[model samples]
Target: MAMSLWNPTKRNSVVLGLLSPRAMLTRWPSQWIGGALADSFEACVDVQRTALRDAGPAAFDVLIGSSWGGAVAAALIAEGAWTGPAVMLCPALSELRRHGAIEAIVDQIAALPAERKAQCLIVHGDADETIP
Candidate 1:
């Protein structure tokens, strides 16, 4: 999902933000149930990466993603597609394992320079079965 906020001080300036498709599932369950699960995990991440790259990292002040979206954000960061700050809420890193990409993703994240990893903040709840 894409969101834009008007910047009151800048006349017509708008702050563009990108959110994962899953983020809307709660509010729009029917939309998700219809066909949102067709895409592969990697395919979804690729779409997100392409959008972020097209917008350029400078276009966004920060990236925020939840659940599977959080995983996509982390994957983009690990792949060097996004260098901006990010807030990941209960990222489903284990989903990568299910798709057989966990090792590579983990390796990429581990190989990142300390400074790059520091740009992301991850929050996982103790009660989150997906991550726990």
Candidate 2:
């Protein structure tokens, strides 16, 4: 089972993931969250578009992220890119100036063809400084 941590196979069962910066670093969760949770799960660390495209067809049971990753997860879902349950921790939902235009999350969500926002639960702390 230990060898399966680095391997993405059917045997890994549910794929629980952490977002960028820590996405590719799977071992850290096992150490920090305790061994029990890591015992039977395959940690998918790479969630970037290029990586996802290169990986071919893959199914995710749920998407969980913090900070920038949280914002990414929300954007991906609102854009109808990823269809799955998600949990965003302190997601950055505001707009940013990119390429001389303001990119807002509200517009992204509104753009969904059939209102296909992925089922997501957001947990944000008022005192959080990373996204503030």
Q: Which candidate comes out best when scored by TM-score? A: 1
How many clashes show up in model 1?
A: 0
lDDT of each: 0.64, 0.49
The CA-based lDDT of model 1 is what?
Answer: 0.64
TM-score of each: 0.65, 0.48
- Over 4 Å off, model 2: 1-47, 56-58, 95-102, 110-118
> Candidate 2 has which clashing residue pairs, if any?
23-45
- What are the clashing pairs of model 1? none
Model 1: how far residue 127 lies from native, Å = 1.6
lDDT of 2 by residue, 53-91 (tens): 575446557778775566666656655556667798886
